[model samples]
Target: FLIDCFVFFQTFFSSQKKMSTTSTGSRLYESSKAVDEYIQMHYAPQDQLFPYDDQYAPSAGFQFVARTATLCVESFDKFGEIREGETLSALDVGCAVGGSSFELAKKFATVDGFDFSEAFVKTAKKMQLEKKLTYSSLQFGETFEDRVVSLPESLNTEGINFFWGDACSLSANENVSKKGYDVVHASNLLCRLPKPKQFLKDCGEWVVKPGGLLVLVSPYSWLEDYTAKEDWVMGLEGPFEALKAELSEKFELVDRKPFPFLIREHARKFQYGVSDATVWKKKCT
Candidate 1:
């Protein structure tokens, strides 16, 4: 059944690609915004920073996040041997509105979420507060209050934290260093930057501790021009190669998979697509 579903989705996505032109800069931005809005409306309901639905449905973004998070958690579990009472820390780079960060928080003892957008950080904080109040299982103790400043006073705690930070630059590393997360997660973030390989290398340096875990997912092949063909790299394979070349000295590839996904609520008729993901473990001396 799963194999059949994968095949059907591959065929559908291929057909959609043939019908559509490669989106350029503004067009790409617009398309991304549309997809983001659609996801926000359908999947994110805690805050309204993004103009979309807030219901918890199976949107494309949600599916992608779910698959990527599963890979990340599985890799971390296998490599780190995480157990209850262990002070496991996690960092979600480019966390957007905190959906993936919240997912991370559920798995680890401490979560530090960061995004370049102030609005995104604010929305993430609001959602974190709401999650604290509504969900008894999510226990964000004092760490949440000390790290996340924008959160409402009513639900301040310590288990989860949010901050404004950029992926391209590791200025956030200073903050991450303080928490010392055992796992670092980057979802579809590296490809969006101007220097994707460098971004990955920086993530390796800042987020993951020795013997920690690094999980990354990206649909775009390279970090060059979004619309132009100049010096462009192909999708997951190219980025994965570059990541390996850059991080091999300090990390070892542990697991890899392709996440089949589709842009839910798209007006266009595309059946399915996929994103490539990799899990690496920091070398332990």
Candidate 2:
């Protein structure tokens, strides 16, 4: 099961990059398969993520994105990071389908969601404008079931915005948020960048405000197609330890734990993973 999942993910990740201007690439992101996969991951219920009744089936891998998002706000409250009744702006980097972005909107004054896929941005914007989204879930190869996702009443969609941009180069997003944000989220994205170290630097330098939070959740599933070996953030040392060393100069580690995620491949198959989640408080310099 695990091997099949990894192979499927490698193929998916390899085709997910944005193409260069000079070259025309296949539009896989616009395909129904791509959209359906994200919808199920982001909007599907916990039971759907772990529907099996057998005790051996994977559990606690559901609601990965939304849970991590809530983790940021909850951590702030737990540590007294937020002032009394203070409002904050947030950025959701690699926000595929906008679940975490909307989750952030529950507490944040404003949230900006950025992704490399135009289809994801379009779908998220549709949900923003219409307050609902219709998608299909794969039951088997070429077989699907129709589903609709409604915007939760608890979320404030007015202050949320979605954009198509690259995590490695977010100048356009930086323009949208000139001052920086109180919280920056990039779940399962570090290993997907060609230059993960630069992304970490950018978070401290421009993406996150001083004395704010940078929430990262990643499995560190480094692949040559997505990231060069030399650019791996984990490096030769232990994964979290190396990441800790990388950000220690600019950020203070506040919390660390494991977050399990699940991706439904078909009705009977699912890809399960455990991501390391870390919350860092930017130094107020």
Candidate 3:
């Protein structure tokens, strides 16, 4: 039954893609204010930030945060147990709205968060500095509702920094290339890049330290607008084998599992899917 549902969705989505032909390249988030706003509202919602009268909007915020927190811990534990008082650093590549990054900051001493969208990074920075930011969600076609999003007043911002960056072109970014972190977390970012293979190789070589951990999660939703068909890692083979092939030389796969997440489009509609998560320990060079 589940397989049948999956097949139906694939066919429906593929037809939709065919019907909506915008261009050959992915619509970069930098150009889309609506996309950035939607991402912020989707990932970084806290119930306390919204008014009691509008509680319906933030219905999934707690669940999103809880799942992100679990992924952070699982990413760290899959590598090894951390000793008490031991300082560690993490690099959250493609950390949209800083949900997972904030979760990582709680576990590690330092976390550097990066996203390609200027709007997302700016909003994340504002939230870190001010503890709150206002975002909006679509109420109906051509209509939107305003809401405030906040982080725990207790969340430590001293250990976290949000930056705008491209994961595929990490070498040019001094902060990510020079500062090797104990863990590099790339969540739902692989299939979105135009050159995912290069990003995977560059991340293994520069971002993660020797004997460190690399955690990747993706839905394999490869769209021609986001990535060219030839550039996709999931082709004749599946995402598992494709990732293993890309990271095999410098990293060893430790665990593979399914990660479920929910994205609320509006009060009445929600999108839920499971992302394939793979954890790898960087091998000693």
- Highest lDDT: give the candidate number: 2
Off by over 4 Å in 2: 1-30, 54-57, 83-86, 172-175
Candidate 1 per-residue lDDT, tens place, 1-285, comes to: 000000113344433432212233212221223223323322433222122455643354434554566676778878874545668788887776666665666677678877655545665576766542221111122111111213234533457788876565665456665534688888766655545555566656655777888887767544234324442334456656756777798788888777665442222222455677778888865
Candidate of highest TM-score: 2
Colliding residue pairs in candidate 2: none
Global lDDT of each candidate: 0.54, 0.74, 0.66
Question: Model 3 compared with the native: what TM-score?
Answer: 0.79
Give residue 165's lDDT in candidate 1 (0 to 100): 67
Residue 182 C-alpha lDDT in model 2: 87
- Cα lDDT over the full model 2: 0.74
Candidate 3: misplaced stretches above 4 Å? 1-25, 31-66, 81-86, 177-179
Superposed model 1: Cα runs more than 4 Å off: 1-62, 81-86, 131-158, 172-174, 223-237, 265-271
Worst 10 residues of 2 by lDDT: 1-10
Residue 131 displacement in candidate 2 (angstroms): 1.9
The 10 consecutive residues of candidate 1 with the worst lDDT sum are 1-10
- Give the Å shift of residue 31 in candidate 2: 3.2
- How would the candidate models be sorted by TM-score, starting from the highest? 2, 3, 1
Answer with 2 or 3, whichever has the higher lDDT: 2
> For residues 99-167, could you state the per-residue lDDT of candidate 2 as single tens digits?
888888988888988777776778878888887778776676667678887777666799898987777
